[model samples]
Target: MKQKLWDHQLRARELKREALRKYGSTVCVSPCGSGKGTMIADDAIGAVSKGHTVQISVYRRILVEQIAERLQLNGIRYSVQMPDLPDKPWAIRDQHADVIVSSRDTMAAILRNGGEVRRSDLHIIDECHGFETLGYQTINKAVQPRWLLGYTATPVRPDGMGLSNRVFKSMVEAAKIEELIEKGMIVPVEVYVPVKTAKRRRSGLKISANGDPIQQWMSHAYGLRTVTFCSNIAESKMVRSEFVANGIAAEHVDANTPREEREAIFTRLLLRETLVVCNVGIADVGWDFPALECVQLLTKCGSPIAYWQKTGRVARNYLDEQKSRGVLLDHSAAMAEHGWPNLSPLWELSDREPIQKRQQERFGESAPSDAKPIICNKCGRGSIGLRNCPCGNPLFRDSQEKPETAGENLSLIGDAAEFAVGKKNYQKEWTNILYMAANHPTGSKSFAWAASIFKNKFHDWPEKFSVTPTVPFDERKRSIVEVYPQFMRRREAV
Candidate 1:
């Protein structure tokens, strides 16, 4: 059966058309499982039928294979560029495939080898947010596809360096998780964390350092296939052990796990032999399984990309038909700092202006202190761990006492404190966006749920419910403060 995208995706299609009219190059920010491949395939098939060729550049070989399958399923003739695979013939030649799907390395080699991109051919850059690398630079200068379209869910880098206008000129297509949930396309997420614990318990599992949180939510995966991410290799092993001890058919795999062994585990997962599989960085990106219903986040993730990607594992509809909304078993405070997946933040990554600068210019206000997340002192990525940051660097001095436990919640410590404020202010910062969501003609119960999350964590309803009134942005901010206190004062009153 040919799949029809949800209503929002249809709107996204129109947005893509509008953006292309405005700019030659545009970033299409479609959420996961919104039929990005379907959209791409539709264009490829139309262009191919018209006798114009197209080339799709991707980061991983797996993506190339996936795109080819989508094209084939649509009955579109296409060729892949993975010569190293024994069964498939080499595809390094020029202008041969009706629709070309290849990796950056493969595409760069083709261009370096003097392969030409015909003027009518469309070049689709998959995972287009990752355009900051040298490999992408090489491909850009060498090949010129007449029509350029880049697609990604999370387009903004955590380090704050965005794709420039020279690369992705404007946002062509966009949709939010809330919109998808309202349309029953993707599963909506319910984040579970005890917001009001009695002060701080000095012992047991230290809740703040992103401690072993899987045990808290592992039960949620009962009789369901799950993918869990841990903070480190040892933690991954421990989580796998916990699940195994419970007789849940669990296993752990890491970067060192042999290819054959890893493939075997995935095969088990496919056959319903393994209930849960745990890993660190490997499971964070491009690991697609439509049956994934729950994700247990155990990492102290500082990047929005990590949070969005991890939660997105379960954002797609479950194939088993036993589940409706996706359940997020978050113990690492990942959602607290970043807010919910499929919300406005992910959609805002394409802003030509930097968020920080835009806020300063529009409102003359600096972002909340929490907006400045702790970055890895070494790699300059976001950091939340006290000792060995996720990047494996020492974030604190030896002289400084590591909290008696490895994990510390949002307090005292440097980076922890920085992120703590962000977590505390998630609702305050996103008020205007949530207000528009709650009151718009297309508004949903999601706004009420988001408000409840804010009230639970911070003990107050978000105040910006009226911010998007019939007024300009500047007056909106001023009137927002005047009307915010008028909302229900506390969760208790409700």
Candidate 2:
């Protein structure tokens, strides 16, 4: 295929080259599904032609072969120097090629063991979002490539760390989801926040019957073919189980699944044999399945960009004018809590309102008081009152308790407890609460960070006194702390 860069990609690449020329290190931030791999391949080809050795650091092995295949197709020669042949000389050492690709963890190991990268070579970090962690930073600092190029779907550090400017001299390119959607590369999505009358299960959790978080304006009547994001493997599995139990076809995949099975499931999805595919932390990149017309969020995450990325999986331009517009089945809480993607052009279309719209119009302009409980006491489900228990708990109250009602007392204490804990651990625990409440994908470090911060800042919140911080960003500067919060707060309120 002939090489051609989209307008934004061309500008991003031009900026990337200019950054490399000016500063030894630079960063490029682009939205998901924006062809990051293609851009990296093109850059490597140009650098090879200039007789420069390029070493690329990736987080996974699939990425290594993926980039290699792209470079090979571009007529650039390169070799894999993985475990099978670590002793092999550099691919560009013999003047046969100018780029080498390897996993970041591997490179870190080599460098820690006294390996050295050529001083004049270019260093590129693909999926630079992974560098938000300490281990990644240590590896990054160890394998200090003279010329650094960082690529990511988001430039902001999620762990309240100020790494935006530290990793690169400055951002060479910045493209938002809206800009991409305007170009027709991404399809606009309609968000459906299904009303959840079921009693809440946790203080901040408000997912759907499928275990996806419930948000304002969330809906599920769009039928199957929906892709929902979940908070963890447990949550995704819970979502899959609920869908399967409801007679809706569904499958779940996490980072731990076998490669062959994941591939098989992907194949089945492409063939339209499945109704829903639940994903956690794995579908962030290199995934293409155009049949996806519906996305669901079953997990909770801290990043609005991530929330959009998960939803954007189904909103990609299917290249078929006949394809129906994509549908986003949000948990009511996440919809109202994090808001939908800015790229969604649902407001622009008025030809016909879907069944969800008709139902929404009937539900009245505002959610009734009984529909918004102050707190769900039984399961620690917050903001749940006067709702029936999905499991049919006999103790369920009508949420209309009088001034001296015991249920109200219980709910208030639980709410106060959760709020107290959250406030105490706001810096660290916030991501988990956000994930649980918003139902987005996240990791353990986020939880650890929160717990440690709580222990340090509010020793009285917990039963015991202990302070052990795990995240490297705990010591970050105030500027870094400010970057993710305002965006996070906006998402939390959505």
Candidate 3:
């Protein structure tokens, strides 16, 4: 069932030459349906041609079998660790196959219990993030492949580190979502942010299981072929039950879903046999179905990796011209948090957020990006260069200045003029803006202070205060104090 590889797939395979020539280890990152498994097979064939033996390690047995199938389809010689295969190597040295495909855990046991698979000339870690595991470390110590290859779409860790530091020496991006969309390789996405929370309450019409709101929205817009990420198994089952009861013919895929059942569900989805499927993070990574047109986010996740992986499910474009635009339904308001996936930046395995990466490029490694800068209120001198003031009088530490850092997306505010806070405390904010815009009586110091507060609220530049209203000062002060600190993290990207 092998087909000719596309240009990006060929280009990714070609780049592996550089991976081996320079870094010894490299991560080839591309979106799903971009032929990653094909690229891996081509890589295996290339290495085998050069008289190099290869061992491809996958995180799971399911993916290992899939990779094995690809290798076989490509006419590449391979072996595995199954009981049915009499050639399944019990000892690493006995593995003479051109390409050996096995789970990372199996390899770990082989390396630990005196087995010999690590002796290959090249090792391809399929889901290379598993490189962080002790098994990977143990195997690497045992075999130490001359050329190492890692593959991942989201190559990062939650602790603000990239995979480059551990598994791959450097990473090569095969393609971005934007690049693929432009080339018509993937579908473009439309992000929708519903204002009201999705829930089943007594605000009723005839709805199933109190889940009428989401179903109503789905019926209004979005294809029936959908995969939803829920908070937990309970939520997933509830959504599935509701959809099934409503004649959508849906099912739930959870941690407990058997491998056979999971395969059947995915096959049914591809064959257009089901309308909607709900899962508790099961489909978050590595479920590639191009027919999926809608991704319903029912659970709120803070991880950008989870957000990116979940988003990739819908944008897969197999039919090319026949594929309509992908739709994202942000029931959990995740759109407001993570932004559109295609528009999101590509992060290296060891890199932090874009702003921090820029900060490292500018401020040097000694300085941390998250560390807030100290600005002098009296002299208007900020932490960008110096700490002390030139005026001789020591500038008092003003916590009130620049309270909001940047990174919470400022683009969320659609209408800046429509924003209002009717209170005396915000009036200070308003007055400060009016003064700053005028370059006024208190000098630029007040201007800077006001702009920070303004950016925190509007998430953008302020033009004019056409109306002045009156209200309680405490609430105004409280709201400003509350909003900026939380949103400031998103401003770092700017």
Model 3, global lDDT: 0.57
Instruction: For each candidate, give its TM-score against the true structure.
Output: 0.63, 0.59, 0.62
Tens-place lDDT per residue, model 1, 122-168, is 77777777776536656655556666778877676664345667677
| Model 3 stretches astray by more than 4 angstroms | 1-3, 60-62, 83-94, 105-116, 133-135, 195-213, 220-223, 352-494
Global lDDT of each candidate:
0.57, 0.52, 0.57
Off by over 4 Å in 2: 84-96, 105-120, 160-162, 194-224, 285-290, 320-324, 335-339, 344-494
Query: CA shift at 453, candidate 1, in angstroms?
Result: 23
> Arrange candidates by TM-score, highest first: which order?
1, 3, 2
Candidate 3 lDDT over residue span 205-228, tens digit each: 121111243444333222236887
Candidate 1 stretches with Cα past 4 Å from truth are 1-6, 49-51, 73-77, 85-95, 108-120, 160-164, 194-207, 210-214, 349-494
Best-fitting candidate, scored by TM-score: 1
On TM-score, who's better, 1 or 3?
A: 1
- Model 2 TM-score? 0.59
